[model samples]
Target: MEIQENAALLLIDVQKGFEDEEFWGRRDNPAAEENITALLDRWQETGRPVVYIRHDSVVAGSPLRPGQPGNDFKELVEERRGKGTGPELLVTKTVNSGFYGEPDLDTWLRGAGIGQLVLAGIQTNMCNETTARMGGNLGYDVVYALDAMHTFDLTGPFGWTATAEELTRATAVSLHGGQFARVVTTAEVLAGASAS
Candidate 1:
């Protein structure tokens, strides 16, 4: 916590595509939207820089395909957007990492003099994790909001299917209290940012 003046909030892929029941629905962390909303409110109140990243899937007919309704932020998240206060920047990328080719999130952060990033949003083990890793590698101190990220149950080639909850927890354990990032609750983040 305790965001520096040069700190910015990076909200990754809180899109309607993920929130839609027909799409990649059923997340492990249902509270992610609420947590992200709380953080957004606090960031708005403090006038801290808030950056929103939207993922544009390159695959045709993907839920996040450009110009689709699902590409927009979900209802809960949409409530946080406007001209007055909330997010200061909205960057769209086709890759899992926001720093990838696209709107140049890394360059924007650097231009804003941001050395610290508070990250939150969907798919804890994917987009969120990738962004956090990239941020850490790029020399930014990252703080991941534990309750503000989520993922879906995943089954791959290992004959093992991990629930979203398990993936989220494991990702947090690996990121928090480590060199990558500090994982903290929304309360801790709010208090720290406020105090800062």
Candidate 2:
């Protein structure tokens, strides 16, 4: 698919909180950050809008809670997080879906006349999945940058546990086709950025 002028890269919750392997517990897609960096670089070069979605956990003592060091954006994106005059938008949310919390990302995008979004970030089965679903439900063209997002193993009811790989695959399966978004690798997104 071709890139649209109104499309912006929506990076959700790539924060230091998720960097704690002890807490996250065996995440899949180890290269996710690299892929996301690649996309960010290309987007910057190609002049596509960039949005950074940060999560501020309402639960006290959570790594992502406000005033915590882990709540900050990961160091991998430090240089690209933007300073004065940079063409980047910083959006903060308190929930899984970036669109649903304070500073309503959906509303901001709509006001900016953005109608298409490319998603990348942490927890593929949670925040990323929720955002992609909302993006489609809200009538926006959404693309899932598959390799640029990841998730940790999750425990189900009883002793069942789903590996991160399984969750990632499930997310891809659920979002692909006409459901929520078209799942594409980071390469495709980078190519689209270059071609644009």
Candidate 3:
């Protein structure tokens, strides 16, 4: 689980929209913010590359609409800005996949010779899952932090409602053991990064 010198952290959509207590307030992935902050601190100290992706809703007047406060990175993330050795790269995207039809994250990663990517973010079943799949298909060594991603209960077409804990655990199970990516705990990631 150790992060190599060429490793990078891809933090996806830890935005104010996802942190809105009034909306998605019932989600059960409570460790997400703390995990993300811990990883951020480790990445900053180690001088590893950290790339942030912010989701922008294409629909006008949505919570994540452009220029809205909700579209910005959350307070925890904003506080760490400009404190790292290098400038933080921020990619804004209109779709679930950050690499889809926009800033070309794959190309950028390849150009940087980045082979390992550690992913942490919000909405585990949506943006986080999509990005991890894309990163795996693109040949990056992907590590998904299980406790560092959050998802809300979702009602499926058959009227089945998945609870928040169900969604989080399901996403973790889907990502772990090589169906898509390796799932690791935040503590594991931080320890590995520190040892690297």
Candidate 4:
């Protein structure tokens, strides 16, 4: 999990919205935010670029509506914003992938010459995973900071149930070994970041 100089941390939807337990239901990885914070600290200390993707949900009554309190960045990210340290860019998206909508992350990444992305944040099987897959298809070296991402339980229309753990495992299985990204634990990611 050695990170290259062009590697940047891409945090997706680490917003206050996800904190609403009733809205998101039961989630996994209670320490995901802690891990994301650690990564942010390391990236800031080392002066590596960090980017944040916010999900500004267009769905009315969604927790991520732009004017809602839940739409605000998580306190951890907020405290670091515009400090010129942790996140050098913040891209907002209306969909599952950060590469879409206005201020597209793909264009920004290319403009910044970023070829490697270390992904961390919420909804492992949703926005985070979508962005990772897109990054891989676009030929960027992608790494999944596994322990730094989390998701909630889901029930399909047919009553099929998937726990957060199961979803996370599926994402790892789908993305590993050059398919999309190599998944690494947050601890491993921290160590690698330090080493780099």
Which candidate number would show the highest TM-score if scored against the true structure?
Answer: 4
Error of 4 at 174 (Å): 0.9
Which model, 1 or 2, shows the larger lDDT? 2
The CA-based lDDT of model 2 is what?
Answer: 0.85
What's model 2's lDDT at 148? Answer: 96
Flag clash pairs in model 4: none
Q: By how many angstroms RMSD does model 2 differ from the true structure? A: 1.8
lDDT of 4 by residue, 119-191 (tens): 9998999999999999999999898999998999999888799999999999999999548998988888777
Q: Candidate 3 lDDT, tens digit per residue, 1-196? A: 6777758888999998876766665787687899999999988988888988988889875678778889999998999977887435778888898777357788878888889999999888899999988888888889998888888877888788888888878777877755678888999988888834
Judge candidate 2 at residue 57 and give its lDDT. 92
Alpha-carbon deviation at 1 in model 2, angstroms: 2.4
Ten contiguous residues with the weakest lDDT in model 3: 17-26
lDDT of 1 by residue, 138-184 (tens): 99999999898889988878698888888888898888746799988
Q: Candidate 4's error at 187, in angstroms?
A: 1.9
Which candidate has the top score in lDDT? 4
Provide the overall lDDT of each model, using Cα atoms, as 2-decimal numbers: 0.83, 0.85, 0.83, 0.88
TM-scores for the candidates: 0.92, 0.93, 0.93, 0.95
For lDDT, candidate 1 versus 3, the one ahead is: 3
Query: What is the Cα-based TM-score of model 4?
Result: 0.95
